[model samples]
Target: MNHWLTAPILIPLLGGILQVFMGYAPISLRRTLAIATTVLTLVSTIVLLVLASDDAYRLYAFGNWQPPFGIVLVLDRLAALMLVLTAVLALFCHLFAIGGTDEGNRQFHSLFLFQLLGLNIAFLTGDLFNLFVAFEVLLIASYGLLMHGGGRARTVPGLHYVVLNLVGSAVFLIAVGMIYSVTGTLNMADLAQKIPTVTGENLSIVKAGGMMLLVVFALKAALIPLCFWLPKAYARATAPVAALFAVMTKVGVYAILRVFMLIFGNDAGTLANLGMDWLFPLALITLTMGVIGALGADNLKTLVAWQVIISVGTLLAPIALGSTAGISAALFYLLSSTWTVGGLFLVADMVAQQRGSAKDKIVTAPRMRNRTFLSVLFLLGAVAAAGLPPLSGFFAKLLILQSAMAGPQMAWLWSVILIGGFFTLIAYSRAGSIVFWRTVDGHIEEPKPLGGNVSTAAGALIALSVVMVVLAGPISEYTDATAAQLQNPDGYLNILNTPMVGEDG
Candidate 1:
């Protein structure tokens, strides 16, 4: 067993447990522990990424049991990429939280680490049952984090979030049971091998199960009709919690990519490409709705929350294409949008803090103390979020457009994405002008002082967008390779059929 394969999951679990015991300790000590653990997880995930670059599938099975019979964690380029992304986002958010947000609850660090633990498990698990388990873990942790500040604003949205996820969880279990009844296996690789052989009534059941799974993932991804819970829930959370929740949607997207492309892929005979037809149209509609929401939003945090849906729509449209190029483009855009939006959430919070009672509303207020600095950060985020040139978003969207050139829905994809971006640009411009440029011409109110830790945290995340642009060549190549790896399911499926080294078959 590769012990490192478990590091991402274990580190966070251990950290959260330790944090629970340290509930009475000084906040500084708890913060130190959480940051140290996250940094360690980041290093481990980066190492895994380098190891996975060799294009080999490594599995860590529990209790000496092989896949299809034991719980396992699978490592590949895609999982590694997600792990690193989560850790990076969590580190910055944790830094910002310690600056003051942690004061909201004594167990804040504990809940935060547990949330990371859940996200890491969702990415690394090798079977459908464990995936469901991962969802519950994260959702439970998120329940506490979302309600950390404990006000009616967080309470109402948090209630909706909890209830919706509970429904999703039930649906997820039913779908898993249905699939298991038909295939006698829940391991992803085992299902991939067996799904092709299912026929008649069993095949129909499997198909229904697959569609049910799509519904659950769609809800998690906050796609269209199921997305209404996101804007309010996200906008009401404390900044650090909201920023971390940015990657929560991607977990659903990742599941779609892993399950659909591997189990119900082209080789699945009667069930091949099971949900692709529905995914494409829904993705486009989600994009349109997201931009519309942004246009109508009256608060900065709400606008950023809407942008998350926009990013989701942007990501899934490419992914729904199910081509190597399309998947690659989506991966690049995923990194760009996740970091950018996470930064924007932090920036929104900072701006709201300085505005006193106005608190992130779009209406004009006295000019802020750090007006120039905050405006610049907000501008950089706006440029990237709007897909303007010389930033990661521009390149990511360009790649998506290029990938769609040969698809049947090329025109639809092109029109929706480009127009969505245009509207996004206008929305941000309106907010920016009202908040930063059109401030009241009078003595500035006693704005709160910005903390170095929070400012650095937000700035670093936005700066990554510039770094992504600079490293686009190698990053694109990596995503391209990951996409190729995803397309070849044989590499993933062979894990169950192959024998472990130096062990009996």
Candidate 2:
């Protein structure tokens, strides 16, 4: 039955429903339940990661139905890695929410669980239609969470966020329809097999569908022109929600890897390497724009939001290289970037609260409470985000550079990434000094104590980032193996051809 493969998604589903029923329960109880569920999810995901490390793939077929006929869940090293990363981030975010981010919000707990549910399913699902369904689930849950506090800051951005995604959703459906119409299949494995056989006009239709889907995924990933909605929407959301959203852009990156490499990869004959040429140029531009946005941001939260876009751009650039080494490096950077940004969001919120009326604005104002502690945290985060030496980001970026050097657009990629890092360091340094290095003065309010949960949450993330730095060797090896598996989809396709147990024989 391979229940562990499905547990990540189902546990959150049941937990969210249970939370909805307990709406009238004490906040303590609701939060306790959410934390426990997230903990269980983390535990389950860890177990699956261990299993996947030993075995390349695990499949779970619902209703015991056969391939291409019924829904199935596929868990590989990449999927397991994403699930574990998501669970860890969700646990910390839930703890931060417990520290009062969920106050005055009736459905925060349930929405949090549902968000996990959607993200889990998105990572686990093996079929195209189910992937779309997972996207909707997560997007709907995000809408509620984004508007949780209900302010003009949240409301105005939320509307833009909603409209942009709605348009993305429509484009997604059209892409799905075109692919299905041409290939006569929505199952990823089936499409992988059918795509290579497509020819002439049909191949063009399939290529159009594939390209359109990339556009939709690019929108989700906050790529360049489609990325304007991310900075404001993320900056305006409450800290906990924004922290949890650190993985949202990566979801789009994941989709691109899964669909392009698996369905429209080099083996797809006429469709071999369809989008790399276009993606490479766009990815470099995205990297440039993201760094510029960070430099010009008005506040710490806005800067962190821009960092998310920068991370996306950094990841996509390597991926556009279409080499296994590039993919492996992209995977490692994805892990480091998500944790660093999520932790920074929590820190930014704490800094804002302690700054009184100054909040998180870039201009110098009053000194902050826990300035020393927050300073250290921000310093570590900046080092990581900027890819400085002795941290995970440095190694991650180094690996990408090594990979890009072997690709055709090596010079352009190297120039953009290195230059982007320089500007990012400058921006973070500027913001940090303004926020944490203020002059000692009497007008500054007495430093208020941070919530126990807030400090604990932030500390946990910092520790994780350090751990990533410490364990770089093993993590890189794992991602290398994951990329190898993705490059050869034969095993994945073979399993899809096998009948599920209890299915008529």
Candidate 3:
């Protein structure tokens, strides 16, 4: 298992190939194959994670050249944490994909595996160009997944999805080229070292490169001005597709946190030298606008999409705070929100599908009287997203506010955070008020026949939600570790890009 270092990349690569081939097989066999391959990929990733967690942060040069001279896969606290999150989300999506899967869909397995592969690669790579390659892998897979079996449903937004991401890919390439031109290397740790030594004309070039790079990551993260593509595209997708859609934007957000912290934290980094003065107001407005959008949206699925945007903006507050505790809070919030927002979307889809669609209006059949599931789902979702106490999200926000409040002269932005939380409360309140209270003729009605294994997918989501409550302690510790690791960059750079005997000479 020397490839264990490369297993994260190779697992999905093989699984994706299997999926594409299986897509041409009989429907029953195809689905069974998809599930098995995905689950195997999950197992592969978990084994890798468990093995890596016990070891020092390390690197594997793909072609045997060391450090700055070779393309490498690096494992450290942050990358490992993202790998775990992606796997958890991917597992749930596959579970939900089972029954929600459309008939005659040509390449469900192929696209799903490829998407997962891209995410894992993005998480594992220690190089910037490789990061861009991974992003494109994800983009292309997502394009196919978002539109598959969507028919007329995906056409309009699918157009935006394709054209917009293609443009993003182009801009991303240009950014990579700019960085390589200036640094003469695309390895992340090497760039972190060279970025400080970089001088003269490249200073402005580096700044422009950083800004353009941020633009690319932000577009994917759905940060405010660049967030237009998110809701429309996600809202138009099928349920399982939407579930997977939640994981995709997060990769972009993760990139911003990873790249910015490593390169900028190295020396007078991007956010530090800039004091977040570069775009604090814009991020604040993004937070406000996302909350407002959630307030106005009527559809359950679309509302969930807006909430994802809200979480991304709330996440920006701490990056602006630029303190250890502030980033610790952001890490906590990121972990909880990713779980909550993604789980909520999948559950909403289940309810919507049972009730006929995701419309604001309730319309389940009189015989389909199982309001219990909806009640449980909405209660947890509202409590989770709104940051109610006794839940992980609440603890995260509390930690963030503590840091933001204590930071030097960030009170204005901190107040915006408090207001942002209130707006989120209101938005979640509006959704819950209608969803849990609206009278249907069969509010207490019995569960209607769901045709397949409803308990499998729904049960898994419910279990994950419940675990968020029970596992808060250990999860918080892990988040703290990741946050602290981001604050101190030497461990990551030292491990991955530091030259050994033959390489540096």
Indicate the TM-score of model 3. 0.91
Give the C-alpha miss distance for residue 261 in model 1, angstroms.
Answer: 0.3
> Please, what are the lDDT tens digits per residue for candidate 2 over residues 1-505?
4888988988999999999999889988998888999999999999999999974677888888778878999988889999999999999999989998898977899999999999999999999999999999999999999999998989999999999999999999999999999888899988989998998898888888898999999999999889999999999999999999999999999999999999888888888877878888888898899999999999999999999999999999989888899999999999999999999999999988888778889877766668899899989989999999888889899999999764459989899999999999999999998888855564556655799999999878866778998898899999999999999998789767665776543
Q: Estimate each model's TM-score.
A: 0.98, 0.98, 0.91
Which lDDT tens digits does candidate 3 get at residues 258-319?
A: 78878765474433333255445666778788888888876777778887888887787676
- Candidate 2 off by > 4 Å: 406-408, 446-448, 503-505
Worst 10 residues of 2 by lDDT: 439-448
What lDDT score belongs to each candidate, Candidate 1 first?
A: 0.94, 0.90, 0.73
Residue 18 in candidate 3 has what lDDT? 77
Q: Rank the candidates by TM-score, best first.
A: 1, 2, 3
Number of clashes recorded per candidate = 0, 0, 2
- Selected candidate, larger lDDT, 2 vs 3: 2
Superpose all Cα atoms of candidate 3 onto the true structure and report the RMSD in Å to 1 decimal. Answer: 3.1
